[model samples]
Target: MEEAALLIDPEEIAALYRELCQFPSLSSACIGPEVTTQYGGKYCNIYTEWSQRDLERAENVKFCRQYLIFHDSQSIVFSSPSGNCTEIKGELLSRDSPSGAQKAVLRKITNSKGEEKQFLEVWEKSRKVKSIELTALEKHGQVYEDDQFGCLAWSHSETHLLYVAEKKRPKAESFFKPKAPELSNEEELTKAERRDKAVKGEQFVFYEDWGETLVSKSVPVLCVLDIESNNVSVLEGVPDHISPGQAFWTPGDTGVVFTGWWHEPFRLGLRHCTQRRSALFYVDLTGGRCELLTGDTKAIWSPRLSPDQCRIVYLENQASGPHQQCSRLCMYDWYTKLTSVIVDVVPRQSQGEFTGIYSTTLPERCWAADSQRVVLDTAQRSRQELIVIDTLSGSVCSLTKGCPLGSWAILTVDRDLLVARFSTPNCPPKLMVAFLPPAGKETEINWVCLEEASPIQGITWDVRTFQPPPEQINPQYEGLDFEAILLRPTQIPQTGKIPLVVTPHGGPHSVFTTSWTLYPAVLCRMGFAVLLVNYRGSLGFGQDCVDCLPGNVGSQDVKDVQVCVQNVLEEDPLNPQRVALLGGSHGGFLSCHLIGQYPETYKACVVRNPVVNIASMVGSTDIPDWCLTEAGLEYDQAALPDPAQWTKMLLHSPMQYVDKVQAPVLLMIGEDDRRVPPKQGLEYYHALKARGVPARMLWYPGNNHALSGVEAESDGFMNIALWLIKHLK
Candidate 1:
């Protein structure tokens, strides 16, 4: 096993990363061609890959915005407006601003070496599209990722453009600083030497979800552009504390409505910032001033003005409790200065066939043309469902009933028609369209499947949901439970008992549903039965069930998983000894605990970015509330860093059973992970080594908590496959 581990090529990990990236990813329908690409009468829309932007930048310095049809899915054949078959490729542009004159840039990229063709393109509609580089201050200290044209917007007149860009922070001399070497010195420093030469303290500059690549790269700042004059200026007056995005033009286009964070410094870096405080604020285009719309209170996001421009609707959570709380549907009246709760509570179960309000925050533009109703995706019984909420009558209606079992998310919506990205347990992501029927005609709306993003074949799935007996559930969580999903090869193994891979999801708050996922698919292909334990504390089971994990972490949640696993093994021809475990973050916390608490039960374990010592992590992590609340301690912005809290945290931490772990483990960590710092993994790794337990660890540089840099995630998955083969197989 050591020899084989040594032989694993570092490049193969990158190859797998690219291979995974090539897998069909279905993004929301920001915009799609209602007519075929052949009808390119005026707006010749064309989409290209962003990674390939360097190619055109290096080779073709100048290009014209001529073509109109482009997208990121498959090279699809569709009828053009001219009645001819046309191919649409790259990602579809946002239809929200299609009425204006914009500048579009197109670039082509080679995806997965040769497996797929992808192009990165942006639309530039103005007559003369120009580019102006920024000054040191104009860059405004913001890193703008390809978050679907983030921080980029056009005014109502299409004359002024608004965007947020990254600006470099001035370097500061540190107190524990080392003297800088002369640049003209005898020898040049290697990259590693220069990196090591930089002096830094342990204090984090900002609390970011993913700590490394972005935080270090740049800060976010709002910018304005004059299209005809070819000039740019950084907007001022808005406080630097907030990181705002998803800007929308107000009624008169005189101001902007956007979402930004408002929290203490300790709450900065958490991935789930919504758990703290988020609000919709309006920014004056002229004065550059900003003001909070939702007041200084509960979390609110994704604010949208009614089509009539008189009313507004946004997602609101009234209570500031668990990170995974339910969203309340809020409505605002511009004239009356009154806000109403259109839907205050998520019905524990469907009222009549009407599932509860869509749980997650909506992306931009989910409103109907009449602006009377809104649509969003919801989680009910582990199924991704689509529903419409009528603002005036507070009526809830179901849109998807007979479609294949899967998940559906909004891509683009206009008037009553919506294009959604659909994924079933059986196949890859596909573009689907649905219409909102007036009031009573819910069943008349049909969800039609259209072009696939990237058609992935050979891989198939057999997934089912299991309800662990209520009697078998942890007594404390009895009657308050969620189901576990079991997936395997459609054809049962004929020989030895098939190995079982038990996966616990991160976000003890997050749920594992009957959706298509790559990890489980990979394991199933490797000839293992995979069971995803939603257990308690997961979503879709209602807020009461989700709130159960606070003080019960490491105990109740672990028991739920163990019982779920035992129930599955008894019902199937699965091996009881060769059980393999996989998880990340909270899931990893459970994995470490599972291996130690049940030392003789499992064969191997794989953990990525795990939390081993909550006491230590409470200080280093961005979300201190996670450690506090999960330990059953009532979290306060000020009353923490206490010894009483440490006792509870240590009790819940996996570190308590560090000496009993028997299963050989593989640890994958992101060097820049802020969520569960890399030290947590290192501590666990060294403990395993000291105990003489077989262990291996890998660290990906510059990756954040997710370790999702294409090559890094790929490397982690490939090594997991190799490691599992040596142990579980």
Candidate 2:
């Protein structure tokens, strides 16, 4: 057994991850001014990609390339077949721009020592130095969208910049808090205040999201920088209750429109609670004050103002409910201040399953060139579709239709056309340009490929779909049918079934789209068939399906996943005896629940940032309401849960099945995670250890619930691959 484990070549697994990471994963993109004839292409200048020769080098030492433009609507590979970033020539504006002809520059560098360093150099058109700067749009702690890279914008003229920065560090909270006078001498404090400060040492800080994400601990200071004048200003008068994000400049540069969370800063626990109250606000730059645009605390996201500033359209819930509220496209008239529901997108109309806006984060460039329409990314039948909704008529139309089994997003919007990046279940992201139809007609969007096939290409990705039987419950909310996407080798010999790895996405409210995923793809390359089930309680299936898992997260979700896995094992070429379970977040919670309940079924289990103990998590997690809502108890943010509630929560948690786990389990956790709390995974690890179940654990320091940080995520991904490969093989 030991020798077999040694032969599992971790380098190969790491290479696969590194190879995929090398592709510039384009998310938020902007359309450039002109389609230049240079390189016979116009450029979309800035993007994020793997930094170095491999994943480690890219994570530790990476070169930030300014722009990687599409060369004449043709797909091109930027790296060699063996996965090396190939240096290519471009007409990019650089400091040494003396030559009228484009020049070749050093394109790649290595960081063998693993030193923490970054290089930033700038020069004006004349190539001269200027001593000028702002307080830096940086923060003392992690920025709000560090993980998903959220809410970054450039003005219409691209001069002034607005971004979320950690303005200042907050003071620690004490059991016996002190109240300061309105007017006090800064030089001299009262004796009692001085004594209290001297005796107290900072302990635990209360957070509502991941660790150190408290708005009070390090508030998101809205900073605006004037690049031309070198003047920086921070917007003031924002109520202490609100934590602002997803901000963008309004038309004519009058003010900034942002999604603001109005919560008691003293009781900062709802920042990550999606069901919590949130609204839109306008920060008057000239007056230095923030005005509430939407007075009601409705869950709102991605407020895209029209080019004419006539209407501000955003995604909001039709009903005020916890996580599973039906989502709708709302347009607020700027002149009359009247709000109207443009479309009722949820409640599963049966005709459209993926019409609900992906809602978590809307693309920055959602508005059309005409501004009479808005383009959005929606989940339909487990696949991502980029649809444009007409503001006047409230009609929705798909931008494209090929491979509805994959994923798609509009990165840049130019006039009526869209520059989108998408991928299939087997393909990587390919940038293309598609257009919306004229006023009342529905036209199929023909995508013009911006770049060629991916750098690491040529592997055939075989993908298919399977549906599990409806739940054996009442027709109302139970047994709403769901689907799972299967991926494996394209060419399989007629023989025993391939090893199966069952995966469920996190966000009991989130669904697994047919997008290309690194983990599942790599596992498939490792000769295993992967199953991604968009089970009960997942989005895209509508509100009824989404609402199904909340009060029955453990039971309902576990059963759906089991049914899907059994279906795959029974019909497909999947090895039932070698089946394994993989998931993270709530997905991890379900993984643990599955292993404990059906202990003998799974041969191995791997979970990252899982919730093992809800009783313990309820006390420390940022979203305490999650514990209550998922456990079948109503959440009252103001009231403490009773003992009976605690008992029920414990029973609902995976802890109840600790004694029944028979699979060899591998646990991965972020030490600084505040969502589930590191203690949640640690407790389960120790419990399994004490029970003599074969268990191993890995913890990434300073990582939150999304353990996909550069180094931490790469290591965690490789280890998970190793663990699953070792056990399944």
Candidate 3:
């Protein structure tokens, strides 16, 4: 491994990063795929948006407009959809009418003088556009853009629009400030007089918001816009304790149904946390009355209505336990007002059996033409597979079964035709369309490729499952096993064994699917084998697997990763002596633990926003509940930890074993990250430096926990490659 690292050129690594940036990733596909008569012939219309790196802007730019994808003589052709307009600037949210006759777009436009203004535009099918400037008084505050509390929806009649925004409040002012002079005429009062009447001394008040990625979003209120009258009004009677979002029109357009999150006790980090207490609610427009549609004890998400509007289907999970778990698919009958579980949570599963639904949310339009079958994507071990569930028969079938694609996701379902995106570790995402097969024949889908697969050269991948010996397995998780995807260069060096990089995903709850990920592929292209590990606690392996790591974090998860690496070394022709570690968040936590517990096993380590000391992090991180819960203790915001609890937390932290670390370390930190604060990395960096161990830290100013800004990611990856090359030797 040292010989191979010594032979690599730095210029080659930089070139590989630049080349990989050119590949566009699929951002989102528009729901309700259309079949129009004017677009050449009778062809399925698939619209998808893509995102790519913009090196000039130091950001990732999304092309939010639609692309027309159609089949033509054994090949797929891409073009612009009919009536597609030029992509708007600073567009925050957009929605189309049910009939596709009109479109509503929300944009934040800045004038030449640098004054920012919000505008709402309505475009008609006949090329007529109505643009309305929204003043601060009318909009209340900036629109919610994050997924947890943002919503923009059109009424069935298309005459009104409903969205979620910050609640209106009086501007804060100083209590002891001077009063404005009286104007001669009451009607000609100056601006200072108006400001004097506003509430005072509230600027410093701290209002808790939904944590992490959701910032400055404390109080979200539903607002409706009368398109014809050009008036906006906040919906009433939504209960002052809850924040509402994901709203849509009811069956008769007389009410709105949405998800309401309780903010009574406090708000925890909501992004990627499905266990937050939330429930379905219906608010009647005429009387301003609110009613609970689902019980308040469980978390619910994405209540998709059936095509016939007779029933609604949603996902439910435990409200306060694991952040991610096996969700139960539930349906609520509109007429009967009764909810039933269509698919219950599976505690455990045998090999190749249906584990359970492990998806955060379902697609906007997932119901089949018959309205009894629903199509959604879910994690099934090491891959993401598209599955269809029969609401009546309670039967589930995999639509992408027997297919080689490592990941499958539904884009939209138009009538019986389903549009989906699928990819493998070596292949980029491609579009495919398939007609829904009849019941019990879901696996026999004759898919028509809308786009050809673009496989990256010099990279090959295979999925490997690892199981511990009976004595080594945790007794509580007897049947538990883990999996890893090994990506290697197609042409290995003939002289030396290939160096290995063991990469674990961030969410201990998250699984590393055998999908096409850019960074891992880049490492393989650089002549390194990358092992993406999905440990015992990862999702898609049943609730038992997910529950295995919470009480046993820092030890069980660490051992599982070690077991995977050892098994891979025994089975494959990889150098065990040249092993390195790369991970972020909890994965980083595991990486830190590995180096300390088994210091001599790894040659180098790179951690991004790692959790170094849980005892210290519990007081600073956005999700304090995570610290206590993962440490096998119940979290109470009001109860402070005693010395005994602190000692236990410290025992599980990587800082306790810092003295045992042998590998040279590289710390990549996002300064503005809220999930795992930057101080976590700083503590580790300082500790290693004090001990005379080689260590380095790179801090990105505006990036978040993911360090996902295009420019930041590019520079970080380049630095990572260089650091690994320099130290592995």
Clash count per candidate: 44, 9, 0
Ranking by TM-score: 3, 2, 1
Best by the TM-score measure: 3
lDDT of each structure? 0.65, 0.66, 0.83
Say which candidate scores most in lDDT.
3
**Tens-place lDDT digits, model 1, residues 1-729:** 111111134455434334444444554444433443465432223221112111212211211111232321222232122232223343222323435345432223345655323222235533434534333222344325444225456676666666655544434446666665566443554544433334355344653432323353334556666667766676665667676665667777788777666533533443454465767777887888887776657777667777677778877764355676666788877667678988775535444344345355675668887788888877765777777788998887767767777777775565566667677554656656655666667667766555555434433444445555655455554556467777765555355476788899998787775666777765665566788888777777666676677888998888878888888789877788779899999999999999988888789999999998889898787667788888888777767566777988988989899899989999999988877889999999999999999999998887888876656755577788788768864
- List residue ranges in candidate 3 displaced over 4 A: 1-7, 31-44, 64-88, 126-128, 137-139, 184-196
Question: Judged by TM-score relative to the true structure, which candidate is superior, 2 or 3?
Answer: 3
Name every residue pair that clashes in candidate 3. Answer: none
In candidate 1, stretches whose alpha carbon ends up further than 4 angstroms from where it belongs are 1-21, 32-128, 135-139, 146-150, 166-221, 239-243, 263-267, 286-290, 350-360, 453-478, 494-496
lDDT of 1 at 330: 89
Candidate 2 overall lDDT versus native: 0.66
Candidate 1: clashing residue pairs, number: 44
List RMSD in Å for every model shown: 8.5, 7.4, 2.9
Cα displacement (Å) at residue 549, model 2: 1.3
Q: lDDT at 86 for candidate 2?
A: 38
lDDT of 3 at 132: 76
Candidate 3 lDDT, 1-729, residue by residue in tens: 333433268788877877877676665665443554666553444556667777778876766444464544223344335444234368788776788778788888888999888777898866747777765445567777666767778888889988888887667779897886565676446565544446789878888877677878888999888999888888998998888998888987999999999887777788899988899999999999999999999999889999898999999999877789999999999999999999999999876889999988888789988889999999999999999999998898998888875898887775667778888888887767777877777777777765566789988899888897676688977978888999988876556678899998878799988777888988998988999999888999999998888878898888888988988888777888889999999999999999999998899999999999999999988888888888887888789888988887888898999999989999999988999999999999999999988999999998889999888898899888888888876
Candidate 1, poorest ten consecutive residues by summed lDDT: 48-57
- Residue-level error in angstroms, candidate 2, position 38: 15
